[model samples]
Target chain A: MAADWIVFWVCAPISIGSAIAMLLQRNAVHAALFLIVNLFTVAVLYLVLGAPFLFAVQIIVYAGAIMVLFLFVIMLLGVDREERLVERLRGQRTAAILLGLGVVGEVVFAIRAGVGFSTRAPAGFGAANGGGNPQALGRLLFRAYFLPFEVTSILLMVAAVAAMVLARRRERPVASAERRAQEPIEPSEPSEPSEPREEEPVG
Target chain B: MLGQFLSHPPVELGPIGPELVLAGAGVLVLLGGALVRRRQPRALLLASLAGLTGAAVVSVSLWRWRGHATVLGGMVQADRFAVVARLILLGVAALALVLGHHYFERLGEERPEFYPLVLFTTLGMTLITAAADLILVFLALEILSLSLYVLTALSRRLAAVEGSMKYFLLGAFSSAFFLYGVAMAYGATGSTHLSTIARSLAGQTGNQALALAAVALLVIGFGFKVAAVPFHMWTPDVYQGAPTAVTAYMSAATKVAAFAAFLRVLMTSFQPLTWDWTPIVWGLAVATMIVGSVLAIAQTDIKRMLAYSSIAHAGFVLVGVSAATQEGIQSALFYLLAYAATILGAFGVVMLASGRGEEHTSLGSYAGLCRRSPLLAGLMSLFLLSMAGIPPTAGFIAKVNVFRAAVDAGHWGVALVGVLASVVAAFFYIRVMVLMYMQEPLEDVEPDPSIVPRLAVAVPALLTLLFGVFPGLVLGLLERASVLRW
Candidate 1:
């Protein structure tokens, strides 16, 4: 247990440091690579917490598929022209302070209330929500939470449709003549030839 | 007496037939869509037809099995209340689907995916009203929310993306609160089943603290879904930005599902803790009503105005919920059906009148609509009047029942505030009517003939009048179906 604690203590800082560094990095591609490393470290943290299922999911889902998709979009779009620096305007600092204070107050209140928490090392996940075993999770998911699971699939379908709609260009392009027709007409000034048009002699 | 007969257990499969039909229909639609994707148009048409048929079949089944009963291993127990709510959800989904057929066609987006999504979402709503467990409630909530997020952003337009982003972020955040609350409650009571939890926590230590937190969090989460005060920021943007057809579906269907779930959570799981939670709810109800109606009056954008009106109606429904009685639950169910019909009609009018791409939701665009299209204007006015809770409209009857429930519950302050808010709400509904009838035609005024919006307008308008003239038709059904087990 002491050894485990030592490993956790060592890894935690590295994980958090890498995450912050990844966010602060200027080079877009480098930041993404760092994010991959940071995500893997978080997966390790989940493993330390004895949640192997969550650990695997974290690595495979958050680090692998979702991030890859993110990177693909970012690379495909090419971030150079689109990255705009944001400036904090006046009174924004005050607003942030107030929000921070509210958060602090909430945390303090929770702490003061002494909400007994059970972070005790679990015998297994199954004991959590009436047998948190994966099989139980599956049963609960299919039998009790079946509707939400189905709805999620529909959401995915909608996402697919949105992607298709967003990606697909219109088949018909507007003709130049139509474009010109749609343009508002401006009154023409009587042709003032600045350097009187060079006289073309018929002779 | 009917419940006792059902409880006799020898032969009592009469009730819960609607839920079974919906479940059957959902499976059919999903499988059918998967099998025939290559024949896109036909598949899409078939999927929608299946959804409509399923909804109709389920609604009819519910009508036949009006007496209350539980089934399917106690996962779903339906009385008149659940039946009526499910029926409303089905009806709304049907109208929304009709509008969707035209909407997608006009937009040249004939994805069969829309019908399956709508079918599954409606199925989720039905399950929500029938949910007998805490886990089931949360699951149903997510099911509805997930579908709506997609539906809210269905348009693939910039506004849709923006609106959906706001909705998703806020919605996901609220869901976390709900989950946390559930976790707390589970920890406190060692059960996720509402009835079991109630029994376990009846005299348990720290039960008040845990139950209060759970109820509060659930309220906040459900409030976001229903467009109640403070959590209503997403309503206008999402409603205005989503495809009008999708918006109509969401407005009617989402509200019904959320209230059903909310009422279930409050009345079932927290019944013992009501005295601890009722005052807070009383405050939220009054504030939601006053804020929703009053703010609506100041909006110039038609979509935004309707969004505010939806919030106001949510408040009215909350009054019924806060009553914490069998009558209150029944009234809430009836009110949801009434509000769904009226709001669907209003959006149907907007969708019908809207140009292709739906860039004309501004109030000014509706000026002199009566002169251009008398039938459309007259229908729109009927919807608007109903929304304002005017007589001979379903909305009025819904509000009266809710108000009676509140008065019965001895929340006279809330009732008075509701009445005042109704008066304030009338101004905006009337303003829309005035714009349609009295104002001169704007320079760019033109009718875009689309079959989708027209049908959308027709069904809800006809139902509004039908339900309005015969209030007992739905209310009586509600009374017969209402189950009062807590």
Candidate 2:
């Protein structure tokens, strides 16, 4: 129990502090690194709560894979370019701060009142057993949650298709013509082909 | 070990046969788009229509074979309500695809992928109506919404991209709220299945705060989807920015699907908390109707006007839902069917009236459309009249049924508000009509010469009139259909 208290006291602050830092950081890369720290600390906190499977998933899926993806995006998009930070709406920041504070207050009150802190597990909760999280989860998922599982797979496929469709660049002869017109006068060099080659032949 | 688990219970696929067929069709269209050397847009369109028809057939068969049954371990319910909703979605999808085929071909954008996306979206909508569990609802909602976001931007115009981005961000935020609500509800009831939650929440007054919070969160989430007041900032912009066919589909099919799920969740799982949530929904209904009608009167763009009009229709539907009675559900279902047909027809005419580059959507562009093409102008007038809830039109019957249900359920104030709002909404619809028939042609633009879009407009117009004259046909069908049996 003392060790658990120690872990909570140490990891909770780290997680909360890193989350704030992540939000405050101006540099995208620095923000991403802070997010990784926050995720790692949350994983430790999950471990302290005896959710070993969730802890592992938090570290592996979020801290490892997702953070890497975020860093890659930041680098690919050029991390040094500062965002404009335009305030499109009047009093937006004030309203955001007020809402954020309200949320924090509600959360704090809930925690203090132990609204969701129950020692007893509800009936039919499959995750009550220690060290059997993954196996029990698999059993419940495949047995009772099979339909949602399959639907989730379809959702992922739809996401992939949507990304592909949105990211695809249209082959425009007009664009090529404009590019050719903008090119410097090079009489000695043969004018580039009228139509750009179909890069990947959109299927 | 696997065999032991498999022996738990045999999974049944009959309940979800429509979803399966639609998903399979979507996959086939996608693969054909990827593999075929010469992209045949016409063939793809035909295949998508056939798939939707097949799915409709399956849905009808399911409704006949087993009118109501919880299947796939209670993840979904194959009931009369879901089957009917699926049929409506399929019909809307087919019409929208037909409209899209001509719209894209006219614009010279050969996007074969459009058909597959439509199929996928229809699949999502079908699953949403059938979903009996909260998890399934969220998954299905994401599938439908993500495809719609992409479809909104599919035209590749700057406005299209901007609208889609705003839609995607706001939609994602709402989805997170919905998921959080699901978690809270699960925490409260220890189950995500609507039947189980209803059972657990029945007559239990202790610890009601969490449950009330869950209800509010869920309502907020669905309000965004249905474009209710305060959560409806995205509707007009997205509708105006998206392509006409897509806007039509989004306006019709999304409402049908979202309202189906919304009514299911509220009527089934949250039924016991009616006293708590009814007043809130009553306020929303009033606001949505008034805002949608009044603001629409100020819009010059035909699509933007239609967007606001759709918002008002959503309010009328919410009036029925807030009543929370059997008659209310039946009337809401009938209203959805009526609105879907009428809106699709209205937008189809709008698509046809536009020039080759889709530049003639403004109200000014519609001036003297009667002189341009009498058939197009006549069809537009029929649809607009239907929207305005004129006598002998489907919209009038729908509004009357819903308001009657509200009044019967003792929501006389809400019913009154709905009637007054409809009166206000009629003004804008009439304004469009006056523009078409009374004014001079604005630039002598020719109507689109596509027979397909004309057929699309004609079918819905005929159906709207048929339903208007014979509301009893749909009302009787709804009478026989069992809803929320779980």
Candidate 3:
């Protein structure tokens, strides 16, 4: 019990602090790094809660893969450039701060009131009931939750098709031919050097 | 140890046959589009129609075979209500496809993926109506919403992108709220299945506040989807900005599916708390009716006007929901069918009247439409009359049934508000007709050259008249099918 308290105290502050830092960071990459730190600390907190499988998943999925993807998007879009802090809507910042404070107040109230809340697990749930075991989790997922699991795959497939449809580049045939005829004088342009090189051999 | 828990549970596919058929067809159509060198809009449209027809047949057969049974380990329920909702969804999907074909071709942006996306959305709607678990409901909602977000921006115009962005942000926020509500409900009741949640919640008063909070969040989530008041800011913009066919589909099918799921969830898992939630819905219904009707009268864009009109209709449906009776549920179902047919035809006329590039959706452009094409003007008038709740129209019958349900439940105030809203709504509906018939043509615009869009409008117009004249045909069927047995 003493060690559990020690681990919780150590991890909780780091998690909360990193989350705040993530919001305060100006650079997208820095914010993403802070997010990774927060996610990692949360994974450690999950470990302290005796759910080793959940801890591992939190690290592998959220801290590792998802954060990496976030970083990649940040770099690919060059969003690391400092964004203008100009307020687009009047009193937007004030409204946001008020809402943020309300959320904080709600969280504090929930924590303070939680001492009286019941902690007893529901029927057929707990560590002894294989809640911490990946094998048991997998079995339950495949058996009872099979329909939703399959539907998720369909959802991902739909997302992929939608993304391709939205982002795929359309080839303008007549314009492309006109551009090719005029490309010789602009071969040294840095933005599209490879495009002209690829057409040179074909031409 | 592994072998002990590895036994496979018996899985039944009959209850979910409609969803399966749609998913399979969607994937197949997607692959076919990729493999084909040229855009095959005709073939893909035919394929989508076939899939919808097949799904409808399966849904009807399932209704006949089992009537009501919890299938897939209580993840989904196969009931008469779900079956009827699926049939209505399939009808809307078919009409949207027919209309979309000509609309896309006219815009010169006919893509094969469009039909498959429609199929996937229909699949999501079917699953939503049948979902027995909160998790399944969320997944199905995401699937439906993701497809719709993409479809909304398919036009690739500035307004389309803006609309899609707004919709996507608000939809994601609502989904978060919904998931949080599910978590709270699960925490309070220790289960996500509707029947199990209800059973566990019965006579339990310890976590009443938490449960009430969950109910409020869930209501807010669904309110966003159905365009209830205060959560309806995105509706007019999204509706006016999305392609006409998509707007038509989203207006009709999304409302039907979301309301079906909302009714099922509340009627099953939250039925015991009716006294607590009815007043909330009552407030929403009154606000939505007044706001929707009054704001609609101020719109110049035809699409925006219809968007507000749909919001008012949503209010009427919520009145039935607030009634919380078997008769109320039946009337809501009848109203959905009638509204879907009438609105699809109305939007089809809007799409046709707007010439190429969708440049003529303003109210003034509709002037002198009677002289340009009497057939088109006549069809538009029929739809507008139905929308205004005039005699011998489906909307009138739908309005009467829902208001009667509210009155039966002793909510006379709500019923009165609904009648007043309808009277105000009639002004806008009539304003459109006067613009079409009484005024002279602003420009000598040629009628749509395509026959498919004309047929699309004609079919739904005919159905509206048929249902209006013979309300019993749908009402009787709904009366038998509306009881959602868990």
> Clashing residue pairs in candidate 2, if any?
none
Ranking by lDDT: 2, 3, 1
**How high is each candidate's TM-score?**
0.76, 0.86, 0.86
Q: Per-residue alpha-carbon lDDT of model 2 for A1-203, expressed as tens digits?
A: 89999989998999999999998999999999999999999999888876788999999999999989998988999989899898899999999999999999999888767635675545455535633777677777787898889988888998999998888777543434457779887878657566465664332
Give i-RMS (Å) per prediction: 6.4, 2.5, 2.3
Question: Model 1, chain A: how large is the TM-score?
Answer: 0.66
| Tens-place lDDT digits, model 3, residues A103-188 | 99998898667643455554555654474467677867798899999999999998998898788654323334566677666545
Clashing pairs in 1: A126-A131, A126-A132, A126-A133, B79-B481, B80-B481, B80-B482
Q: What would the per-residue lDDT of candidate 1 be over residues B144-220, giving only the tens digit for each residue? A: 77767777766668888898888889999988988888887887777776776677667664466777787788788
Write model 2 residue lDDT over B242-354, tens digit each, in one string. Answer: 99999989999999999999999999999888899999999999999999999999999999999999999999999999889898999899889999998888888888888
- The candidate with the higher DockQ, 2 or 3, is 2
DockQ of 3: 0.44
lDDT per residue (tens digit) for residues B1-486 in model 3? 666665676788899999999998898888877787655789889988999999999999987755337878899898889989999999999999988888888777756778999999999999999999999999999999999999998887889989999999999999999999999888888788988877766768427777888899999999999999989999999999999999999999999999999999898898888899999999999999999999999999999999999999999999999999999999899888888988888888889888876688999999989888889999999989988889798888988999999999999999999999999999999998999989988876676867878987898899889989999877887998889765
Q: What DockQ does each listed candidate score?
A: 0.09, 0.48, 0.44
